[model samples]
Target: MIVRPLALCLTLLLAGAAAAGDIRIKDLVEFDGVRGNDLVGYGLVVGLNGTGDGLRNSPFTEEIMANILERLGVNVSGEQFRPRNVAAVLVTASLPPFARTGSRIDVTVSAIGDAKSLLGGTLVMTPLNAADGQIYAVAQGAVIAGGASAEGDGARVVQGVPTAGAIPAGAWVEREIAFDFAAMQQLRLALRSPDFTTAERIERAVNRAFGRSVARMEDAGTVVLDIAATGARSPAHALSRVENITVEPQRKARVVVDQRAGTIVMGADVRISRVAVSQGNLTLRIDERPLAVQPNPFSPGETVVVPRTDARLEEETGTGLAELAGGTSLSEVVAGLNALGVSPRDMIDILKSIKAAGALHAEFIVR
Candidate 1:
């Protein structure tokens, strides 16, 4: 495959330029108390096309089925029942901030039993609870399985996760969190990626927007905002004004490598010192042939077998020791590396060796 050095250089150059632009405070930090809550519940999924769990294999499924029947005033005590259309499932949903009662939210359903698939299943009325053990919402809807499955007596094929599914707008909120956003006197902004320079910039940006010192950098990861000093109506109003302020955020030099995909990503600040590198590949080949030797016609009785093998070691001609000049910019670094005429997978190894030699001045991460 032909390697496009110019395209790679341009991509790195553009990435460096993009990082220099000012970003909004909202994108760099999160409001401390403004977040979503996770809700989970154990429930049952029904109406499957014979893909439900085996009652004998999953005794929990049988127990839950009996409980549902009894709750519906149907006497199932000591009754032997085997159903192939029901499965036990775990329902999960996120309660968004400021969600009001009667509001609808989406939910995910995952089969916890040995059900082959959850396709065409409907979740029963399941009460979702939060960490406080309080019922927050109820979930019940038709499941949209992520994949499909086909099976027969001899073979089976499944794509994606057929046992997990999702339902859009499948739950109604029954309670609201007790936090009063309007009554807050102060609010903290938590940085998604902590950086002292970024936090200071955010503090300055917010204070500049309010024309006063209403924001302070508590640490590398936190910036506190004084709602009363902003002269805004409430904490919500103050945050609305502060979050829109723009500031240039600082980032560290980092090189990320995804080995499976042969992808290499480098931040704008990544740097490298002048270094020489050599790369090559070795291939080992082996072949085996079994020969059967038989006695002459109408002569001796036994047959003999002989084994033959061939093996060879070969080395591919690679680019000799190449010099990578120290780079002051991302484009230069990418160009220098590309000049070696290697594929991305090979480039990853070169980078690793460069880091080990103390020539690569950035964090090297391999996934």
Candidate 2:
């Protein structure tokens, strides 16, 4: 059956319409020196219902427990301990820029043991620290697990990631990062995807928006903006106004192929040179049978037995060699392949062969 319209069948992929809604200058370019820091802490989740870690497999669990108790003024140095109601977890969160003490933030907790699940668990007061080993916040809250499990006798079922959970506003900030964001005079708009063309576009867009030559393309990946000269209060306010400006981002034309999934994706600009393709398959088969013969009971053949084997070969004529024509447009390329009347799986191989032949001008990616 025909799947495409006759008149509009030619493949035409083009850049979509420009984005809407003002993207804040804060989103477009970063104040050269302002960014968040990542914090991580090792902690424990308790109050589980018979699904915590096997203390034998994760001995460090006990070590941390002993340490916690010591900090809380409990002397357990000589006590033998084993608990199945607690699971060791790694707590992680990002400290946002300009965060102040008393502010709340979310944290993620993931089991670091053989715990079956972290459901109905509560994280203890765990100090989250940065790479500098200084505590910035403390996390503690009831875990809202996204996954769970069940087991009874010999049957069990599970869903989602029961070993990982998260807490909303679970951590309290105790310190502020030392940064004078409002004092900066310059900002850098880093292109998420670095391209010389895109960088120039961003530089031009920023300068045009403010009617001043405040932004300049420093390199393919970075654009430097003169915030002080842009007439804004400071770096922070300047970014707030400029980040919403729009600039077209450029990207190279590419063809992505998932070999395992037999999927092909091509960009609008992907082009191909003239080429011819041919495909065919060969098959060979063999059959073998074994039979045993026993001597007659009355025969003087000592009741000997013998074995016989037989084999045969058969061949089926393959769908003769097929040829595919080179195509200029994406639609033409697909139609040309369809002319060969081969399944998509076979078409994938043909595309690969064409790429190896240097006839496919676009990037041919095999994922």
Candidate 3:
């Protein structure tokens, strides 16, 4: 019943009159030289309720603790300390483009040692460095863990991940990336999905908006824009204007199937040639019945056991040799498939067979 309902919905979707609309240029492409940088730092999280790393098992945790105490002007050079309320963690954050000093960003804290949990811990002031080995931000705040855990003598229950957490707006930016966006003579737009037709459409749309040939398609994946031709005050102004232009993007026909969930998704342009399909199920039955023989009282000597088995093969009569004509539209294709009266899982197998026979004409993806 569920399969039939799903098929009906898909048929209706194909038969609908609605069509895909145009998309803004900003949503379709990424601007060159405008991206984020990854920043990471090793730090310590404290104030856990006996759920931190064991000092005996994690020597690095003890070493970092000693360093932190030394930095705070506390002399613990020779004294031994064992603390169950601290954990070693790695703090990570992304420095967003155009981020300036004093701006705060979010950071993720993950336990790097054998810590039980990071539920109620507070991250120490940790300096986050970028790929260039320069400090860009400092993170320090109370962690908001996404999950929780509890343990008894013999059992433990954990829901979600208990050792990883995040701090919102917890890192303060200290350095700025030196990128002169205003002085750039040109900018490039990189398509998220490379297509020659989409790239050409974007080029034409941009030039039409300015009434001049300002943007040119460099390749299927890139479009180069001449900022001077737009006559904007700066490169930023030129980009701001170009990013608002809308264009319809073209995509390839594709079919994706998830065998585990018995689901299939097809693009509107997917088509199938004339084909014949037959489906049936064959099942084997096996049964075992062991018999026991016993001696009569005051009569025979010993008891005997015997075994017996019955096995047979059965095949159910199914839809035989269904012919599907070549479909001119998506609705016809789906209608023909549904006419076989098969479930989605069975339809997936049929599609695979059709593709093997060179009848299905779309990119097939199985997951």
Candidate 4:
């Protein structure tokens, strides 16, 4: 069982190593300021079949509904409403980099009140605000929930999440965030996974692509780019030429285990030192059975109940202390462990014990 997975991982590692010559720079790092901004807003969804929020239970829904009605020139200041066809929701979207006015972006709507579902509902115009407390975009469209729900008198069924949905091209961009990506003299590339070796390789790759020392490593995670030295008209032009340059990334050896799922994942760089491991488990079982006692039917004082239990203990055999030589590769380590013939759960315990004994040469992580 373990040999197959380790063999698969070994094959994948070898395939990846063969293609480690170059990776696109854009895939390796993030260009500073070229990112999206999260926008959120409060909104209302109408047109539901009595599955919306109960006004009595969620008073805020009533408040927002009344506010919306009043804003639309309907004078219902003191009127009470017990409608079950409207829901209060939160609208969220991301303003992509270089978004212009009139550009459309997708938005997600989630129920904030005790609404049963947001399906078959239309969102009224809602203003999305940024972290700076300024309205950035307005989202309004029909919500297409990814789930469905059905309920009878005594039972209910749901698939996916009915209280949340999305609308593609739902929000129209009204204003653009101020950023000077073109006029920037220097640009910084932030590595997605910060590593000194990877960052240095990226710096070297970028310089080699430009045929000059245009990029330099600032830290383990950041690489500074001299846009002026690239002799490009703008920083955008300089970045276009640099992003295609690929460099192989470096990562630390790691082994992660999910105990609840009995899953173990190892990196190609994982290794093991010489050690011996013993694997076994003791299992105990108990069965309860109640015995009934009765006197002769005609002359019975009373019927009596007696308790009885059966207990048994068993230990697995054929598993004992097995000595393993030093494993310089992930496959060897996995093959060594697989020789014990234990389940994944038992493998987790053995790996933990090996790590505790300082015989595991990789970082051990448990989830």
TM-score of each: 0.92, 0.81, 0.89, 0.92
Model 4 spans with C-alpha error above 4 angstroms: 1-21, 296-300
Which candidate would rank higher by TM-score, 1 or 2? 1
Residue 266 of model 4, lDDT score? 81
lDDT of 1 by residue, 104-170 (tens): 9999999999999999999999999999999999999999999999999999999999999999999
Q: Which stretches of candidate 1 lie over 4 Å from their true place?
A: 1-20, 295-301
Angstrom error at residue 320, model 2: 6.7
Q: Any runs in candidate 2 off by more than 4 Å, and if so which? A: 1-31, 282-331, 335-339
Whole-model lDDT, candidate 3? Answer: 0.89
Tens-digit lDDT track for model 4 on 51-129? 9999988999999888999999998887977888999999999999999999999999999999999999999999999
Indicate the TM-score of model 2. 0.81
lDDT values of the candidates? 0.89, 0.77, 0.89, 0.86
RMSD of each: 4.2, 6.4, 4.2, 4.6
lDDT of 3 at 243: 93
After aligning candidate 2 to the native by TM-score, how far in Å is the CA of 143 from where it should be?
Answer: 1.5
**Clashing residue pair totals per candidate (backbone < 3 A):** 0, 7, 0, 1
Clashing pairs in 3: none
Give stretches of model 3 more than 4 Å off. Answer: 1-18, 292-308
